[model samples]
Target: MSNIVKAKIIEKIQGFYEAVDDNNNKFTVKLRGTLKKTNDKLNCVIGDIVQIDVEDNVIIGIEKRNNLLLRPLISNVDYVAFVCSIKDPDFDIINLYKNLLWVDRENINTILILNKIDLVDDKELEDILKLLSQKLKHIKVIAISIKKNIGIDKLKEYIENKNIVLSGVSGVGKSILVNKLLDIEELEVGEISKKTKKGKNTTINTRYLEKNKIKIYDTPGYSAVAIPDYTDKKEIMTWFPEFKNYLSLCKFRDCLHIKEPSCIIKFKVSEGEIDKDRYEFYKTLVENKGI
Candidate 1:
């Protein structure tokens, strides 16, 4: 038996994978023809470090993933680029929360990108941004217009030297930002329906882009968010970094904070200690995520 050679799969399409061997040599190998991929886990995403068995220059094994995106089916993500738009598609706050949830759930840090900034004048967009600034703190928010190529450097710097996963609702400009980031002029763009102004979801699978040691995984855009599995509403509360401390003071151990007495979470919400929209949305997520 020969020693199993390892390869990092950078992209997969139509049963063939573009992988880089340990020596940084890239090859397009068929999954079944080159390696016996058992398809073990459902959570495997791009950017994953995989172990491959090779004999006589043929790959054989695709070990496992550190983490993966459920819908796009990629793994080993390092960071998440959560994009929202100021116009064209507009911002959906609820979807924002889900993107935040997805990143935090996987322990991936996030960088918030506000796209289509050129659509609105500074004065017109100021208020919405001020509101967002108040609600979301501690995370980096970069405003950019892919059309004008403005603010592309900030996005370029953010994902540079790292593996990033792009996530957002359809028509919010996820793909636009991706194209601008790579500057490849070859990435696919999604079309939005005129009636609903929502993206047509061009990306069917997770795809990878790499340059200068930076890797990006672009996920298929969705029109809305499907809440992840969370046991208690309070368990979901822990996801909010700003609310973590106040949670200890809640009177009841199982406080949903909707109508509970001596509820610290509610008090904070009332006192502006917590973002009210987040608290309300947390309740909303509970209803949806719960079976």
Candidate 2:
């Protein structure tokens, strides 16, 4: 007879998943593919809780997930930190906005981390923070310097005892931050290319670190984010958190908030209430709705 055991996936390698049971026993399991065969939306991913039908040590079934991330392909992540460097790779606001939209659409709780504060001067750092503050109102922004060991404690408060995922572009110091938080230097930190001035991808695979009752997932970094195509073009506007207050005030019931008559969002942009750069970015998104 087969017995069922509950386990949470910690790492996924090729066709195998590394999971730990409630009793802290590690198991290498294979998927039953039952959910996929039925065309169900559920699929196995790292950070997922699953039940396995095993006579010895093989997985035959998977449980449902509380949540999932498309880009990094992680499941049931409680918190996601979008880590970006201030100087080395430079903060790409456009890419950052796209990431924010992706998180918002997924309805995931996230925070933004502007890393490498030690590389910039006081004035420059202040300006960058001010710009981000205006664009990202109501969202927490933690400015941290991994090398200088600044703001690590405050950052830890958010991720403590939570299933957290660290995602950002290459060389943004995601691995370095993890090392600091975990208090170990096992994870390799990549160096920026001298010729291209871009960060080399250090982490090629998704890995998890469990320590001090903290579960952290470190994902490989990407140069560019390819947002999945939307079935409905109007869904784009809903991703912008800043537009929420002005949404009900729009004249049309299904307003795109661009070139529409009596558009409150546009009015706010013109009146300097909304950042012009952000509005332009939103316009760009509206123009390229499929992307």
TM-score each candidate: 0.78, 0.84
* Index of the highest-TM-score prediction: 2
TM-score between model 1 and native: 0.78
Q: Candidate 2, residues 179-216: lDDT per residue as tens digits?
A: 77887754433333342244343666788887776678
Q: Which runs in model 1 stand beyond 4 Å of their true positions?
A: 1-6, 11-18, 21-24, 27-40, 43-45, 56-71, 186-201, 231-234, 287-291
In candidate 1, what are the lDDT values of residues 1-291, reduced to their tens digit?
A: 645556777776665567776467776655444334376443222455555544433445556666665545566776777778888787776677776776666555677788888899988778877887778764677888887888888778767877787877767767656665666563333333442344243676777776665677777766666666665555776667667777778888787667779998888888996888887777776655441
* Residue 244 in model 1: lDDT: 70
Measured by lDDT, the strongest candidate is 2
Query: lDDT at 278 for candidate 2?
Result: 83
How well does candidate 1 score on lDDT at residue 14?
A: 62
